[model samples]
Target: MKLLINIVRWVARFLGIFLFLFFVWFAIEIGSPDLDMMSNQEVKLFIGNLIMLMGLIVVWKFEFIGCVLLIGGYIFFSLVNYSFWIGPIFPIFMIIGILHLFCWLADVFRIAKKISFSTRLFLK
Candidate 1:
């Protein structure tokens, strides 16, 4: 179980880093949009991307919060774009978020198990 958890955690970390860098490169290639001229939807999309990017950055130190941000940002972006099927990147990030969520849950359960064992030992 520990090995599995580590594997999942590391995989998610690598994928997140790759996605972050890819987005940065893509943004640089495309250049920045004029926020003053952006429509409401475009602005929303920008915000969603920012949130997702922040999630990718924060996930390095905090799993659960990062997972929430990633998933939430994806949803926000999808809704703002009026479509869920925006190529593969959105789904890939969603999968990464799910992976992080699983890692968080595993850590929580492991800690709970240890605490329970210690409590039982103390009671006896």
Candidate 2:
């Protein structure tokens, strides 16, 4: 059980990091105007990049916030651009966020359980 929990925690952390890096890369790509000179709508790209940066920051300390940002970005972009590619990306971010959240909760519960058990043993 302990090993399993540790494994889950590591996996969750890895996913969180992956999500952060992905968002950063995405923001850089979109925010850069040189590569996408054909597109005249620079404002939209700037806004998207800002959102991604915010999501990256929030996700570092708070998984839920990060998840919300990522999922929200996916929805917002898809609706604005009417693109089908976002359909697949949206779920991936949502899932990663959920997994990270669950792992965090599990760790909290595990710690609480240990404290309670230790207290009971001490009292007895």
Candidate 3:
């Protein structure tokens, strides 16, 4: 059980980091290439997003920031790249959301198990 929990947590953390970096890369692509073509506001917005997503990873609270970044990135990307807006990219957000979800799940399960164990011993 402990091993499984550890594995899940590790996998989740990796996915979280990967997705966050993906966001930063996408943002850079948008803000670069044709720097002169991109508006100042667009450059600022992309850079701001990159910084915040990286911060979320550094803070290790990938859920909140990851979810927001995923959704925001998808919508913004769709708007910017209207041609490639086919199929479902919501799954990307779902995957990141699941990673964050499992992290919380592990914490909740551990706490619950601890509480139950304590209750049984205390009652005896």
Residue-wise lDDT of candidate 3 within 33-67, one digit each (tens)? 56578796667545544544553464365455554
Query: TM-score for all predictions?
Result: 0.95, 0.55, 0.52
Question: Model 1, range 5-49, lDDT digits (tens) per residue?
Answer: 999999999999899999999999999989999998889999999
The count of residue-pair clashes in candidate 1 stands at 0
The number of the candidate with the highest lDDT is 1
Query: Could you tell me the lDDT of residue 18 within candidate 1?
Result: 92
Model 1, residue 49: distance off in Å is 0.8
Ranking of all candidate structures by their TM-score, best first = 1, 2, 3
Overall local distance difference test of candidate 3: 0.58
> What C-alpha lDDT values do all the predictions have?
0.92, 0.63, 0.58
lDDT of 3 at 70: 52
Give the winner by lDDT: 1 or 2. Answer: 1
Question: Which pairs of residues collide in model 2?
Answer: none
Q: Is candidate 1 or 2 superior in TM-score?
A: 1
Model 1: runs farther than 4 Å from truth?
A: none
RMSD of each: 1.0, 5.1, 5.5
By TM-score, the best candidate is 1
Worst 10 residues of 3 by lDDT: 82-91
